[model samples]
Target: MSEVQKYTIADVASRNGRGGAPVWLIYKDSVYDVTSYIPEHPGGDVILEEAGKDCTKAFDDVDHSSDAVTVLKKYKIGEIVEEEKKYDANGKKKKRVVAAAPENSGNRSCMNKITCGLLG
Candidate 1:
């Protein structure tokens, strides 16, 4: 496969369908050029509302079907730059790691009670 194109937020924002430019938006840090798909969109002009912006939350709020998602993939032109990416290499959202509590102070008895409470 060809090397995927990389775009910065400014690059995506510039193609906002104004003055004959392409329409683009970001979802999960991946960029898409949806100008050609605009007319066929089931949501009509509603899709335009997200032009040149990150629309992941709005897209998920509607709970798009698998077919819709598959279609969306066809228009993917590239991805947001690495510094701006919210997902890992596998396309999973990077999980926020909570630091484990320090064990030095907690009594063994307390931990045992908590463990038993969970298992019991």
Candidate 2:
């Protein structure tokens, strides 16, 4: 059986008003930055009002299509890490442990490599 990962959504909500780190809406391994879109959300204020808070319940209640899910995957926050067996120079597999860049760092490789080319 696959294990389920847990997040303290309620804890995040409680800290939101106190200016905590922006809470990301993660689904199917993709993280969405819903902070900027809170005020403009079509679902009304209450649903998105807790931008920096935990809104997993609210988000789960929404009606989104599979296509939307596919689109959301494109906004994935962190790089998908894969396990390697050996190191190579051309493929350059190293034992160095590289940490994922923090969210809200304004660095999105997908944006430049994927989004820009498709949108523009």
Over the stretch 1-120, how does candidate 1's per-residue lDDT look in tens digits? 799899999998888888998899999888998999988998897877888898898999999999988999999989998887888877678877789977775566776889999999
lDDT tens per residue, model 2, 47-77: 3454444333455577666765665555444
Model 2: ten consecutive residues of lowest lDDT:
78-87
Q: How many clashes does the backbone of model 1 have?
A: 0
lDDT of model 2 at position 46:
57
What lDDT does each candidate get? 0.88, 0.46
lDDT of 2 at 93: 38
- TM-scores of the models, in the given order? 0.73, 0.34
